[model samples]
Target: MKPLLELRRVFFRYGKRSPYILSGVNLKIIRGKVYCIVGENGSGKTTLLHIMAGLLEPEKGEVLLDGKPLKEQLPRARRLIGILFQNPETMLFNPTVYDEIAYAPRQLFDEGETRKRVLESARLLGIEDLLERPTTSLSYGEKKVVALASIISYDPEIILLDEPLSNLHPERKRRVLNMIRSLAAKGKAVVITSPDLELLDNICDVTLTLSEGRLKEGG
Candidate 1:
């Protein structure tokens, strides 16, 4: 099978004065596996993910999804990649959880499909009871679940999760990991970037270290 995502000698810098976060990062990600990228706080994991998601353009090298350059094939890339940022605020805007969960799908799919997708995703994430509640009224963990649900509503083939367990309770963390495991079982490719090795080692198919911009496999 073709790799879902490929990065070749990629480099990215935040701005002119800022140092490069990702330098010569390269990898091939396959489907039906959970990949964990772990490193210290300043590691380039998030930068690398942003490039793969097409949210930022790399200054050097290229990101290819299913054989096409990311820049040239963003629609295809977007269709296959769903990113849930570390900051849950990046995904929320609507007053109610239901609207937020349904937002992205409504843009691409028909109404009936949108409703079905949103309901399923919300139920899977266990946010169905909070669907009519305001986003601001929820706790940090609730917002995280909602953000993840919104990504599920998109139903991308590859899921890019940045610190999904951050600031979450042990119970909630376990629940989220179980949900991710289920996704991986369904043949979706999941690339999770976190500093928590224990969580990754326990649930992920592979573990790697990201340091000084290089992703070393199975560290």
Candidate 2:
């Protein structure tokens, strides 16, 4: 079977004047597997995720989603790929947690589906009660869970999580990790980028390390 996602010689630059963060990188991620991209800080980890999720365009190379070029989207790409940023702050702007998680679904899915997905995602993340709580008023960790719920609400075939375990307590960490593993079991491609080697080791079936735009052997 074809890989769910493939990045072939992808080169990404932030702006016309900015430097390239990812250079000549090729990666293949199969469905139903958790791929942990381990790397140090400033290692282009998040950049790669953004490119794959169609949030950012690569300067060169192709990002294929099930054999279709997704470098800049051609209508079904967004439904196939979802991305969660490294910082929860980037996602928490709505009036309440309900609206925050409801945002993506409202844009991508029908009204009935949006409501159903938001509630379902909140419950899955064990934050169903926070639906009415003000998003900014939530604790840092709570906001993180809300961010994850927002992404999961989209029901994308592939989810790229950047630093997902950050700020979460031990109990919630295990819960979230199990949830991620469950995604792969359900045939979703999950890619995680983090500096935590031990956490990745425990959670991922495959690990690859990126450093200075280059992937380490067996990373």
**Top candidate by TM-score:** 1
Model 1 C-alpha lDDT versus the unseen true structure: 0.87
Q: Which lDDT values do the candidates have, in the order given?
A: 0.87, 0.86
**Model 2 lDDT on a 0 to 1 scale:** 0.86
Question: Candidate 1, which segments miss by more than 4 Å at Cα?
Answer: none
Model 2, residue 8: what's the lDDT?
91
Q: For residue 133, give model 2's deviation from the true position in Å.
A: 0.7
Per-residue C-alpha lDDT of model 2 across residues 1-219, encoded as one tens digit per residue: 789889899888778888778888998989898888988888899888888888778888998887878854655578777788888887788999989988888987789999999999988989988999998788989988999998899888999999999888987788799889889989999999888778754777788889778765456
Clashing pairs in 2: 207-219, 208-219, 209-219
